[model samples]
Target: MRRVIMLRALVWSVLLFVVSFGCAQERDPIVRIQANALSKAFFVGDLKDPTDDPEFYLRATVVDVASGAGSDGLFTNSDAQPTVRVRFEITEDMLLARLTYERID
Candidate 1:
């Protein structure tokens, strides 16, 4: 009885550890940028964990610069200087924005 109980506990502990590690690896990348009138063009630079995926899909949200109100869409001149939140995922066919502006960093 004692050996059976210990084996069951060990199996459960291993299962939990494996699940937590898998969850940690599935985290997507989220990039934030300031999209004002002057700085409208931006790009995604080298990611920390680079992938060989050819294309990617992005979800962005724009927040009003003055009142802190936010909406789900691209940046526009309507806001004076808004904050843009971009979250991207690697995909096979979905193509997101192309990086035209060169970033020197």
Candidate 2:
């Protein structure tokens, strides 16, 4: 009983650490991309975690400087999707990007 309790505690601790650190990274890129270009960033909005697809997507919004419009983008940690490290920068105006990822469950 004591060993089981200790194992559970360890798992919870590791999960907490990852949640606090990894999910809260601030890497907001450009905000506007006009005329086949990108937007300048005034500020970045908060990161939103996946709801139905919790294991798949990390959603965030960038505010466009020119039009004050928000462009929502998805960041995935999955290997199937483009790695977030190289693809984090939103340099193009993808205002009408279609939802490519759907709920698996």
Candidate 3:
């Protein structure tokens, strides 16, 4: 009896784990954007909820960016590059992302 109960518990545990993992993987879609000097603003519109039962949400993050020499003495002789700032605006119907650049001297 003890062994049978243990087996049933293990099977249910593995089934629960698999179902939760699958649901997590399907929850979000990953998107990547590469920006350059000539890059233009991006917009995504007409997004529809996959299921009305679940709440809808959108998230954005600037993960990494290129760096240049600075007067802080990190790389004095290295070539300088323009610094960029990214801006994001999210609305009910649209998502907008824009980039602006400034020379570091």
- Clashes per candidate, residues 3 or more apart or on different chains: 0, 5, 0
Cα lDDT tens digits, model 1, 1-105, are 999999999999999999998888655677564555322112323444434323334334344355665654435544454333333443456525543235466
Q: How well does candidate 3 score on lDDT at residue 1?
A: 100
Pairwise lDDT winner, candidates 2 and 3: 3
What's the lDDT for residue 45 in model 3? 26
TM-score of each: 0.30, 0.25, 0.27
TM-score of candidate 2 on Cα atoms, chains taken together: 0.25
For model 2, residues 22-45, the per-residue Cα lDDT tens digits are 788788997664675522221112
Q: What pairs collide in candidate 2?
A: 32-38, 32-39, 33-37, 33-38, 33-39
Clashes of 2: 5
Candidate 3 residue lDDT tens string, 1-105? 999999999999999999998888454666565555322222222234312222223334345435863436544323343334544445667645455344465
Q: Against the true structure, whose lDDT is highest?
A: 1
* True-structure lDDT of candidate 2: 0.44
Compared with the true structure, the alpha-carbon lDDT of candidate 3 equals 0.50
Ranking by TM-score: 1, 3, 2
